[model samples]
Target: MAAVRIRIDLAYDGTDFHGWATQPGLRTVQGELQAALATALRLPETWVTVAGRTDTGVHARGQVIHLDVEDEVVIESAGRAKEPPLATLVRRLNGMLPADLRIHRAIEAPAGFDARFSAIWRRYAYRVADQPALVDPLRRHEVLPWQRPLDLSRMNAAATDLLGLHDFGSFCKARDGATTIREVQQLVWERDEAGVAVARVIADAFCHGMVRSLVGCLLEIGDGRKEVAWAEQILAEARRTSSVHAAAARGLTLEEVGYPPDEALAQRAEQTRGRRVLAE
Candidate 1:
């Protein structure tokens, strides 16, 4: 008779959905999740909360969310004498969900698995093309096609300016209640096996448009259009400038989130992030 916690690992292409949140008459990740839960558990739409809300045209590979429901609904309940297995729940959700959305994994969560609050870090990857010939038509939505040859060395140098904690207001969209300052734990620009330019960033948190704005600035440096000091100057100024042109959202992906082995890792990450904000 006790309530159970359910954690779902899911992914979806944001092209078809209007971001992650539910809206009136609009298709969204939350809307699909609510419907799936409703059919599987015979519940209503008000029982789910996601860890993050991505913007339109974005994508996620390892998004996590938690829901509270009756034990019989999640297949782990001892109260249900004849319920199906957890795997069946996953299979059923996938069968009912659309092609673009999938249930990557599902499980009964541990006692304190607060999806949003317990996360330590989030990682994202952005891909940009330096050569037009290398782009495959099939992968166009997932990679930005930049025909101009880029200077990898210059891009890497510019990225160095963004490696530490700073107020990234220039690169982020202003939010009424959210903070623009964040601790960037890792950032790099390099060529991958296919010789395509890639940008990777990891941080405890990100503000709206932060990753895209960062990419916009990095591209300028790579194209010989700006100096490395330009990145530093923009950060120091802490204001949006015409130079920051974010790449298409479809080229970015939410790679993964870092969680502590125990609560200590989360605590450490939170403290580090807090200090970074204050110093900024």
Candidate 2:
């Protein structure tokens, strides 16, 4: 049977999810999403590939994924004859998914789109309310309440030293056989409209715990606990250190993922999948 690749754009509050991946006995975004897709399409099972895998309590505003299904299954199970299969699938999946998760759109994927590797960059934002009074009750789950006041200038100065391609071992949880080298396209700290300190980080990809750890280290500098030079020193160390702890997961949100033009999609995917190494 012929298969059609479907692309799904979604957003979710990750507070109640274990993470993006399916884990045994854990309620996860992947587990919930896959189950709903199967039920909606009347399929035995289906698997999806995500643009990036977020950690527990890390939210996403622009997550993307792709899955292949038999063409006949989509058409026959759509329920409404007039509506397109992809549109019906979106409505059905959202109806069954929990309130925290929502599918924004579902459509046929462009040729050569891999969801994961076809992307050029992933952007994330971390929010911290340094002053107790600045913490909004409604956004408490998404923002970190910091005990000490933060110096945004100091944080941005410290952040400047960590950008560009480098081995980010100090900021990442060591993973077997996975290189810690990554190209950071952007990293900066600034205050948002509500006076909350926000760190915007964009990179080709991130290793486990990189963003949170970077935030934690920078926070130390922001609060005057660590010197401005400390960030560069840690990066030079090229391995995780005892001084750096990953910031609370709740503060982080994956805000966007960027992909190349259609003609470059396959090439970009192939390049991203290649093994990366940084020169000494």
Candidate 3:
């Protein structure tokens, strides 16, 4: 029997979990999903790998994971091909797991689909509270509250200098094997209907604390505390600089992941990742 591949779409409030990886005696997305899979398949704890490893207090709306199952599991489900009979799995998992985690969808993934490596681009949204009033109670978990009025024009101008490829050491947490280089495809700051300030960044990849630090510097520029050239100046340093500030993690959300629309997209993404590896 051949190995079967399964893809799962999931979302969770990360306030309670330590992170995505499984650690003994700690609740994690991978840990919970592996437990559920083991129970459903009557196998030992195994066969689940995620596309992203989100940090504590970070939330995801469309996270993906891949699992390999025994052939029997796949064969038995082949008759009902339109939709996998994963509703039962979702229900069972929900019943056993804590309320914060949820299995949004479960189905068979395309052949050779690698959850992490196959991803083309990752997008993140960061929210800042610029109003003098306290943050709304409802958004406290997801938005960072900053009382200072920010200059949007200034923030955008500084962020523009960071649009292309650059060594972003100033924005990253120091770590071994962590290269501070990344390509920021898009960056924008805007006000939502509720008038909350939102910073959206899309990139092929991000280093640890990169987004938060970027937000911090941009906010400073917005508030006129720092010059518009500050972001660029620090970025040119090509190493961690004390001048950059890191925003609160709670305000960041993994908004979405970009994939190739067709086979061509997949090819292009692979090429891009390959080049990234070479550059590193």
Candidate 4:
């Protein structure tokens, strides 16, 4: 049987896991999922490619991954159950997976699909509750509780200065030979009915710690600690600074990832790979 690739939609609380990549002795989303897949499919081992690698305490609602396996293996894994092979796989995986992680859907991937390289953009949301009344005790794992009152208007104004293409070295954790240049399509803040300030960020790609660091910078502006122009100045410097530490990871969540149509997937993947190599 031909090897087939499957696209998977998943979500995780991310409160206890040690980020997405596997470590030698530490827990990770990738390690856990790979193990579960191997056991379910009766394979010696399994590996997966993820759309994004999140940090500790960060959550995800629309995360994506791709896995490859023999077509007959997937079919037989269902064990004559009255469901599609992929559906049975999903059910089996959920039963084996921990409560913090969930496999939402799985299906045969369209031709030329590469979960990470084919992605056009990724969207993330950061939730912060500044006032005492707005803080929800039940959601402490997901929302950030702040002492100072935040001004959404100020945060939005500061976020606007960060829009468009630029070298975002100031907001990223140093990575050897990695390019920090990215195009931010949107960086805006708004208050929900519950009065939580949510930062919506969309970008072509993000460097390590980019989203949380961006939110940290905006948080100071919202609380009147830093002037609105501060964000722009640091961005222009294009170097990391001690003043702008990353926000708590709990507040951040990967909400969505965008991809071009099936026909363009292969082209997009090639283009993205070339750009990164050139930039590096």
lDDT of 4: 0.93
Top TM-score hit: 2
Query: Which whole-number lDDT from 0 to 100 does residue 157 have in model 4?
Result: 90
- Candidate 4 lDDT, 62-111, residue by residue in tens: 99999999999998888989989999999999999999999999999999
* Candidate 2 lowest-lDDT run of ten: 78-87
Position 225, candidate 2: lDDT: 97
Task: Flag regions of model 2 displaced more than 4 Å.
Answer: none
Per-model TM-score on C-alpha atoms: 0.90, 0.98, 0.88, 0.97
Q: Which ten residues in a row have the lowest lDDT in candidate 4?
A: 271-280
Positional deviation of residue 183's Cα in model 1 after best superposition, in angstroms: 0.8
TM-score: model 3 vs. ground truth:
0.88
How high is the CA lDDT of each candidate model?
0.79, 0.94, 0.78, 0.93
Candidate 2 lDDT, tens digit per residue, 103-188? Answer: 99998888999899999999999999999889899998799999999998998898999999999999999989999999998999
lDDT by residue (66-167, candidate 1, tens digit) is 888877556542234454456667777898899988988778877556677667788898887778777978877778888689897888887888877788
Off by over 4 Å in 3: 74-83, 262-280
Model 3, CA-based lDDT: 0.78
Q: Candidate 2 at residue 110, lDDT?
A: 87
Output the better candidate (1/3) by lDDT. 1
Write the candidate numbers in order of decreasing TM-score: 2, 4, 1, 3
